[model samples]
Target: MSEKKGSLSINSENIFPIIKKWLYSDHDIFFRELVSNGCDAITKLKKLEMMGEAEIADDEEFKIQILANPKEKTLTFIDNGLGMTADEVDEYINQIAFSGAEAFLEQYKDKTSEDQIIGHFGLGFYSAFMVADRVTIETLSYKKDAKAVLWDCEDGMDFTMSDSDKADRGTKITLYLNDDSVEFANIFKAKEILDKYCSFMPVEIFVSDPSAEPEYQTIMEEELTDKDTVIEHIVEPAKTEEKEKEDGTKETVEVEPEKKKVKILKRPVSISDTTPLWTKHPNECTEEEYREFYHKVFLDYKEPLFWIHLNMDYPFNLKGILYFPKINTEYESIEGTIKLYNNQVFIADNIKEVIPEFLMLLKGVIDCPDLPLNVSRSALQNDGFVKKISDYITKKVADKLSGMCKTDKEEYEKYWDDISPFIKFGCLKDTKFCEKMSDYVLFKNLDDKYLTFKECLEENKDKHENTIFYTNDPVQQSQYVNMFKAEGIDAVVLKDAIDQPFISQLEQKNENVKFVRIDADLNDSFTEEISEDELKDATEKLTETFKKALNRDQLDVKVQKIKDEKVSSMITVSEESRRMQDMMKMYGMSGMDPAMFGGSGETLVLNANNALVKYILANPEGENTDIMCKQLYDLAVISHTPLNPESMTAFIERSNKILEILSEK
Candidate 1:
């Protein structure tokens, strides 16, 4: 064969620029594309071997070796898979977007399914140009007596092919790192990219630095297995230790029974897990394996509360594990990574089109071989099939939760606090998920007991009747919580940021149900009936006194005779108005005045049964009457919510003055 040179079979002159600059926005993904192409080549060879068209040794190992040479500024991907001849390279390499895997599948369509082929677009090889100034391919076909072919292309448009003395059986792609992409040629960077995209690929992957000395690890002879390639064996001398004899005398003796031999091996670790936990059957996976995989993949040391293993084949080939990680801090955002994969090749993280927006809060991996990916595989193509996959994932999550609630109520309750945010977010985003999980939703009460919506509604039915009470901050609202407890009333805790909107969504779905904050109102159980005339008189007097002392004529003041005598005054805001304020704050409009969006609808409830109310009524014009009124207002406001800086400062000053008066006494 003679050397041949020609222009690449590209449709337009601007194609190379489009492929390098505009196609893949993320440059690091070039590693994934090239590695995945190597994997496909290996898979095609295996398929050929299985069909008896090719012969392979029983002990032969197929792997993809990534060599990063920083000094030479070149990145290489070598695969011991099906290679191509000169003619094959001319047909596949020179063509743009003509997938060799697709062509192989077409030729062997009757023998194998397309599930194992990772490359749909032959352009995956051209992705090398994304970070390379020059790309070269050296391949020796699996066919007998096939001459090795060397193909090189500079600027990704013009190419040269010639006969080569290569001895390898598979393709080797070398990328001369451009000035801007020199970082990729570093061994550490190469390993990082491999770990990110090829961690769970079907074929084993190893990264190495050719310029660096070979790394060796010593392993005990007993620990050495078939997978290891031992370089040499060394025997260690037995150690001696002082031992206590049966007669209570110390004696020097050999601790080890015999000398131990250890084997030294090079490159003992593979970068990718050929069979990830997600690819296995759920019945075959153990709790420990799930936990280990979670720690390894997500790098989250905190144990996940639970996980959902998704395995399906008929409707669409999908396999994954969704982990509900235990939230370490309440203030931390619930955002998590949902790595999307196509046949074990990672596409991106948190792809909403395939992962379902709500599932983005879960740390997991979903590999759907049937995913419709665009040329770059960075984004999902708009297709109804993708929606089916998304819906399938949501259904699986809902099924897991609802099933747990039915059969494992105790364990379900234990994980409710950690996983409730995800479930609630799902309920808000997915209608089908909400419908399935509606009955399984658990609400933790003030006593830390978990209860469903029905249980909560039933427990409060006799007293509050259809009104559901909840508290956001149990510590800040302890006063209200204790009052509710004393009155034999119950309220669930909704502390997560998502709870407010979630509860609103719940209300919208269940029109008859209502959610009110613990501090939103004074329940009827906390008060006793009083004569209408006496109540009216007390209300009028307290309103006038507070209105004058606070210097606000329009202040809403109500006097109620409460059972708890220790209670002085408390503030209450209408549920609607409080929700409005919360919405404003969530949208970053908290700085706006409440008056601008209508009044806060707040009212001061003065407990008539308390000694402070009696003293104020008896000494309306007393020397300390105005001081007592202002102090009561501040205390009520403080108990209800945090005071603004100006109000808090005034409250502290007033407190200090009162303390001074007491000291003088």
Candidate 2:
């Protein structure tokens, strides 16, 4: 046949501008598009063979090969599946065979594009123009006597087709990489793009580069076992008389019908695991296999604390394994790798709709064949299926955690430390997850014991009254922790930064629950009996002396007779007021006094039963008394917060003078 050429039929004269303008910024996508086209051709042929419409030669293996050469700056995708003829190319390119072209243009007419279905539309084959100056297609149709054809398109508009000697059934697309996209011609880059886009494609894909080690194709295999039909020949003694009629009944003949045996065939290497663990029944999988799969998917050396296997076909086809990894980086974003796939083909990583924002901290794989993707296939379209899938995932994770906590006490406690942040974050973000995981959420106390909110409430209901005492800083608030221990009460530790927001969330979730930081206030149990009327005069006198000595405008003072005389005094703050002040400071709001932090804008409780307070009451107006008042206030301030340089110097001077006086006596 003679060569023919003409402008491409489209709404616009050139498709490159459309692809370049609103399509994307990633230039390497062309490789994925072209490779996907090759896979599609293979798929069409496989479907034909399965339906008995065509016969694939046993010797002809269905495979996709990538040949990249940097020296020539050209990349070629070769497939041995199905090819095309010149007439077919013209028909396909004109927008009849490739259905996605018109739809894609319409979809992207306004919306910015994504990575999904870049190749789904017939335009995926044309994406080559984004990186290549010229692209050539040398293919031989699968017809018994179809001729080979060569089609060339340079400007992405005009193309020519002619006869060629490209002997093979499938297509071979060759891209002459432009100077700007020469990186795509690099062997490593080509291999990487194939690995990213075609890894899970349902075909045997091999990356072939001349520079490859030993000039071999890079082939990887994922095992998915199934029984194959094997033809078997059997021989047995026949039911003699009827079968041997022609041989005159004397001699018995053997007759047996051939039967097909279900045999397991040797699996070949492929780019992806066609059947992932999520695709199987949970009963069919074991703990060790799940752990190994987790390692392969996440590449994390640590075994996950637990995993939730999700498989549902009803509301929507949803299957995945969500793992609760052992989180150690409290300061870092708890962003986990949740790879989303559609029919085993990877779409994107950690898609928000499929994997909720809170579940992003989990490492897992979700493959939903019926997932709805908009024109670009970039993100999941908001639909009922998406909502159902997300709700199912959240429920599955909660069920797994709650089950483990109830069935395995030792294991639950063992993993509580590593998984607490994840559960807490999930509870804070998702109301339903919070509701389900509430019973399993745990906090560690000063006694090195883990307890849930229900357990905490049960133990402290009589005295603390649903108030959970927690310490944000164990070492800094060691004194307070010791007092709580002395009172035989356990104070939970909330040292991690996430623990702060988590505490607030816990309080918000339950009306009766309150998480009070150890230093946030003085519990009512720690307050001693007070004689307000009898000690009013002395309390006022002491409050006045400390105000003058500390040079403060106002001093909210109190006198309490406590049992533990070792603790001379402590500055107390209302939990509500302190939390408000912390909230204001955290937001960097100014105009608040720095000195207020020492007092938390609250009161200072003086232990009137202590020897020091007794001595101060007796010698309320002397110079010694003045120095002692300053020393006591300074001690409380230092314990409340680190002192300023000026305050520390004055406190030291006052202490030295008092020591000298005592020594002289």
Candidate 3:
């Protein structure tokens, strides 16, 4: 092919301005991009060696060294990796493919972030232009007997390349900081950025020492004398005599003075760890090591309840540590807890996509080199791999939980309080994940014992004939729970905001399994069979009397004869109606819309077997009957089912009046 030489063309003169203004939100990332490029070069060289295309020397070390000089306002990153030849620089640098990175990524579409080569677009190196006034690259390819080359580019899109006499095996990039970006030249400042962004890079990185202490040597002072005039120092006669006496009589005495030495600390900071914990095999890691890693990453004082070490290589290269924190209440306080790292470097502030919203309750780090990073590494584009990774994490978490439940029931129950919200959230948000998680999702019965969904259902199937799950507002539903207990049935307490919707979805997924609110009704039909004929006859007469006693036009009342009579009269809202109210509350609505339930109001069910209801119905004319109905309705209202406050207050006043009348008589 004939030699072709041309300069890069820019679509707009605003390109440099865009790079400086909006391309990078933080100027410190420029160092990260350059250092990453250096690491990539070394990684490529290693690959070449494996391919038998090149033989690397034994003494050859692939590392990046950072030098910062505030006086000269210069920062340099030197790398002994695969350097670019003159032609390569001309094509990659002098000619900017406005869409090179995007086009290259599209061309190698099937390749994941781990497979695709870094700096394909060639703009990452130019990121230095974002913070520097002028950037220069001195490089020599790894090919046998390669000539050195120099490439220079200012903040603008223009650049120049030429042959240089400098002998270098790799590349050296020098950044001349601009007036506004002078902080980049400060060794301390540059080290901080490196530590934050490149703490686990594959290659070693070094920065200059700006905080080195000075060494001092003591020198005896000599007396000054004029030329040809020799001055002899004269000591005091008494001191001389004492010195002579001490020297003659003394055994040798040695005085040890503190040594003064200068030490070059080199900023005393590490920019990278070649091997991260997550990248290692689980067999090689211990529980204490995992816990220590968690503490280092999260800075949390409490140890993790449990963790899932995810290491997969098949579909996509993924690895991470997910910790189930000891979440004691504060369910809504989950945010910015799960961090996302690409190649061991933090990429995003919050990994919302990588971590399911439900898994936000978990706190840990997920490092996957397969996750694509843009020029700035500020955000990630969603792809099939991204979705797959999310699904994989969900399944892994479910597996860990299932194993915990099966292996250690007591410990699992101990963590139930912390993990329940996360499970409920997952069951509500992700349908597929919910299906898998349901197998291991736990429910704590009134007796404080934990059971998986399947186990709980199996245990209750024989007694109740149906898989029944119910949640109660423990304080207000205490009476309702007690009533269920009276019937020899067990109930789960779900008080979290997400529990209601979660159980609703779960009910839809499972077969013969139903979720009911404890206060929905006192009827045993939820757990046992009741004769419809007997129930209908008893409910008919009671409904008529309850309607008459309670102003029918004002109060909504329904009488049901249930097997459980411990609750004489309990107020219960239908499961459907209560769900609407919960949804309304979640959406910040002002109470549930009555129209949504077709104007169907909550009903107050009275147990026909209760003596209180029997006496109130028998002696309708007596003074006690009216007082009893009012007291019974109020009691139901206090059970957490909604009631009109006005009616409740009126009942209290009437009860006081009846008491006064009885006392007076």
Local accuracy of candidate 2 as per-residue lDDT tens digits, 1-665: 88887767666546677776656456676766666677778888888989987779786666788888887888888987678877788878645225655665555555554544444454557667788888898999887788998988886677788898987688888999888888887877877776776666666676655554442221112222232322322233334333446557755454554333332333334555556688889999999999999987778998888888888888788888888887667455667999887766777788887787888988988888888774235666656778888888888888888998899978889988888778888888899998888778887889888887888777677788888888876876676778888888778887666787887877776888887777666655776767678579778888888888778877888777766787777776667777767777788854686455542476777877789988887877876888888888877766666778998999889889999999999
lDDT of 1 by residue, 1-665 (tens): 89999987754543556555556667898899898988998999999999998888899999999999999999989999999999899888887655453453344334322223234465677778888989999999999999999999997688899988899799999999899999998989888888888898999998888899877888778887776788887888778999898999999988776656665656447988999999999999999999999999989988988899999997889999999988854568888999988899988889878888988988999999988786677666646898998899998998888999999899898888888888898889889998999899999998988888899999899877788999988887888989999988889999888898898897887899999998887867889988999889888888888888889968888888889999999999988888888888888987876667784668899999999999998788888889899999999988888998998898899999999988999
lDDT of 3 at 594: 59
Measured against the true structure, the TM-scores of the candidates, in listed sequence, are 0.90, 0.82, 0.73
In model 2, what is the error at residue 500, expressed in angstroms?
A: 4.1
* Lowest-sum lDDT 10-residue window in model 3: 235-244
- CA RMSD, predictions in order: 5.4, 12.0, 9.3
Q: Which structure among the candidates has the greatest lDDT?
A: 1
Instruction: Give candidate 2 regions above 4 Å deviation.
Output: 96-120, 211-301, 329-331, 500-509, 590-600, 619-631, 637-665
Candidate 3 lDDT, tens digit per residue, 1-665? 12333445544443454455555667777877888889888989899988987779886767889988888888898988888888777766775555564454344434333333334355777778787878888999988877788877765655677787668678999988889888878877987788778878888887774343423322222422221222222332221112235447734333443333322212223467788788899999999999888887788888888888889998888888888877557444644377788877667655666777777777877888888665656555656767888888888888788788789878887888878888888778887777676667778788877777776777667666565657656666787777667666788877676677777676776666777777776554433444787667656666666666676754555556556556677777777676777666677874656556554557877766678877766666566676677778777777765457887678778879878988999
lDDT of residue 160 for candidate 1: 93
Model 1 pairs in collision: none
Candidate 2 vs. true structure, TM-score: 0.82
Clashing pairs in 2: 116-377
